[model samples]
Target: MFGDMMGMMSKLKEAQAKVEETKKRLDTVLVDEKSSDDLLKITLTANRTIKSIDIDDELLQDKEQLEDYLILTLNKALEKATNINEAELAAAAKDGMPNIPGMNF
Candidate 1:
């Protein structure tokens, strides 16, 4: 019984290490997205934190157009970031799963 407990603890430690490594990798992931017309662009981290935004000078003259472009571009960037995050998490979980025959994570 004690040996089984020790093996479980070892697996837990490995999973924790993999999670930390994945978090570090996520911090370095950058995603850039642009609007359909290429009038607006945004950059964000996999953690969904915006790094920068760019807008075309022509759009500055129209507040409504600029707002619309910003919203659309930002949403695209955020969605990409969210997808990346989800994929990374799933990969980490798969890597951390205990090795057992006839079992799936």
Candidate 2:
């Protein structure tokens, strides 16, 4: 019985390791956001790192508004990326711990 318990524990540990690895990989995925007017584009990774930004030349004519637009676009992009990352992590956690009773996994 003790050996059986030990074996089960080992398998659980292995599952945990796999889940962590999968989460890490998903965390590196990227998301892109474009402004409604298509004047600005921003790309961010699931870890909230900005990958790149593209701005339309026509939109650059208004310097003050350009800054605001860029800021808003980046903020929205970051928010989206964060949400995606969280969902993926939550899913992985649930899948990894599904057998735990009474747990919201």
Candidate 3:
């Protein structure tokens, strides 16, 4: 039983390492989202770090409209990044997890 526990601990450690690595890798994975009218564009990493925001000249003419567009586009981009980050991290963790008795993942 102790041996099994030790092995399980090792597997957990490895899984944690893999998760960290995946997070680092996700920093390079970019997600792009734009407004419906293409007046605003957002680029972010899978880690949910904003890389850039592109706004059209027309958007600059209307402050309120620009704010609304930025909000919508940034929300969409963040959602996409969150999905990607979750999926990749889950995959990394699941792949490294050790199979133990009576524990259903």
Candidate 4:
């Protein structure tokens, strides 16, 4: 029983380490997304933090249009970041545990 507990503790430690590593990598993962009209662009990290945004000069003249495009672009960037985050987490979980039957991770 002690051996089993030790093994479980070791796996937990390894999982924690992998989670930390994933967070570090997420900080460096930048995802860029653009509006359909190509008038707006946004860059965000996999952790869903906005980094930068670019808007066409013409759009600056129309506040409503600019706001709409900005919203669209931001949503796309955030969604992409979410997908990347999920993938990274899955990879980290896999790295932490090689094969455990019936276990999703």
Candidate 5:
């Protein structure tokens, strides 16, 4: 029983390491979002870090419109990034997890 516990603990540690490595890898995965009319574009990493933003000249003419574009586009980009980040991390963790009887995640 003690040996089993130790093995499980080791597996859990390996799983955690994989998840952290995946997180670092995700920083290199880019997600792009653009407005419906293409007036604004946003780029972010799977880790949800903003990389860049491109705005059309027309958007610069109106501050409120620019803000609205930013809000909508950024939200869309973040949603995509969140999805990618979660899926990758979950896969990494699952791959390293030890199968203990009666335990399901």
Candidate 6:
């Protein structure tokens, strides 16, 4: 019985380590997306932090359009980041975790 308990404890530790590693790997993934005919671009980290922005000279000629394109590109980058993060976490969990309670997607 003691040996069985030790074995289970070891397995739990391994699973926890895997989870932490997956989180680290996810953080390394960066996503970039463009909009407004490639005049607007947004970069984001896997943790959903916006890293940088690029706007074309022509877009700045019209403040209204620039604002709109900025908003659109940021939104698109965020959306893409969300999708990537979810897919990565889901894939990682599927391989080992198998959907534990309270660990949302």
Could you tell which candidate, 4 or 5, scores higher by TM-score? Answer: 5
The positional error of residue 76 in candidate 4, measured at the CA in angstroms, is: 0.7
Select the stronger candidate by TM-score from 1 and 4.
Answer: 4
lDDT of 1 by residue, 1-105 (tens): 788778877887888788788878898899999988888889889988888888889899999999988888888888999999989988886788677568877
Report the Cα RMSD per candidate: 1.9, 2.8, 0.8, 1.7, 0.8, 4.0
* Residue runs of model 4 more than 4 Å from their true location after superposition: 98-102
- Compared with the true structure, model 3 gives a TM-score of 0.96
Residue 103 in model 6: lDDT: 68
- Per-prediction TM-score to the true structure, in the order listed: 0.87, 0.72, 0.96, 0.88, 0.95, 0.71
Q: Quick one: best TM-score, which candidate?
A: 3
Output the better candidate (1/5) by lDDT. Answer: 5
How many collisions between residues are there in candidate 3? 0
Residue pair clashes in candidate 1:
none
- Greater TM-score among 1 and 5 belongs to 5
What is the overall TM-score of model 1 with all chains considered together?
0.87
lDDT of 2 at 81: 78
Model with the higher lDDT, candidate 2 or 3: 3
- The lDDT values for all models are 0.86, 0.78, 0.95, 0.87, 0.96, 0.77
Give a tens-digit lDDT track for model 5, residues 1-105: 999999999999999999999999999999999999999999999999999999999999999989999999999999999999999999999999999999897
Q: Report how far off residue 21 is in candidate 1 (Å).
A: 1.3
The prediction achieving the highest lDDT against the true structure is 5
Q: Candidate 3 has which clashing residue pairs, if any? A: none
Residue 67 deviation, candidate 2, in Å?
A: 1.8
lDDT of 1 at 27: 83
